[model samples]
Target chain A: MKARVTVTLKPGVLDPQGAAIAQALGGLGFTGVQGVRQGKLIEIDLAEGDAATARAEVEAMCEKLLANTVIETYAVEIA
Target chain B: MKARVTVTLKPGVLDPQGAAIAQALGGLGFTGVQGVRQGKLIEIDLAEGDAATARAEVEAMCEKLLANTVIETYAVEIA
Candidate 1:
């Protein structure tokens, strides 16, 4: 099974990288870029057999180390 | 409008970061963790009114800066 994990910052968190990106866009002449928030995408290829099992395991991984729950939220997709 | 951009390393590209992540997971005692690839997720908030226009502009941003086209591929989603 293959799983895709998306980890994004919670709202109201300070994102200096996002701010820098938005500013850079303006400098690049790309108008209308108001805000930019950056996050992480992790793809895991597993030898596991069942989708349910893989999803459950990956969720554990997210909770353990893949994501920082304090400032980030994560979603998992199994394929 | 809001746009979500996912940037991932192309297949066959060497990803030292991914390898390091997998190794770290092993140290954390998470078994069955294999083939970990890390990527980026960027969310952009736009003042633009039209979804199509925002998507188009965000695509340009990805092509020019958000992604390194030589080794990474990017996908943009507008909401």
Candidate 2:
């Protein structure tokens, strides 16, 4: 099974990297861009085949390592 | 309107960050882990409402600034 974890900043949190990207886009003359927020996309290849088990395991991974719970939130998808 | 751009390293590209994550997971006693690949997920808030135009513009942004086409690939999703 394959799992994907998307870790994103929580609402109301400041994202400097995302801000920089927005600014850079403006500099590059790409208008109409009001805001930009950046996050992480982690694709994991697992030996486990059961969908439910994989989702649970990946979620555990997120809570333990993949996401900083105070400032970031994570969502896991299994395929 | 909102758009999302997912940028990932090409298949043949080496990802040290991903390797480190996999190793750390192993160290943490999480077994059955095969591999991990890390990528970027960018969310952009646009003033434009038209889906087609937004997609086109986001793709242009990806080509010109968001992705380093030489080693990475990017997909834009408008919502």
Which candidate has the top score in DockQ?
A: 2
Native contacts present in candidate 2, fraction: 0.93
- The list of candidate 2 runs beyond 4 A from truth reads none
Give the distance in Å from residue B31's predicted Cα in candidate 1 to where it truly belongs: 2.2
lDDT of 2 by residue, A1-79 (tens): 9998999999999999999999999999988999999999999999999999999999999999999999999999998
Name the Cα RMSD for model 1: 1.1
Task: Go through the candidates in order and give each one's C-alpha lDDT.
Answer: 0.92, 0.95
Q: Judged by TM-score, which candidate is best?
A: 2
Give the per-residue lDDT digits (tens) of candidate 2, residues B8-72.
99998999999999999999877979999999999999999899999999999999999999999
Stretches of candidate 1 exceeding 4 Å from the true structure: none
Q: Report the interface RMSD that candidate 2 achieves against the true structure, in angstroms.
A: 0.5
The complex in candidate 1 yields a DockQ of 0.86
Candidates 1 onward: DockQ, in order:
0.86, 0.94
| lDDT (Cα, 0-100) at A29 in candidate 1 | 93
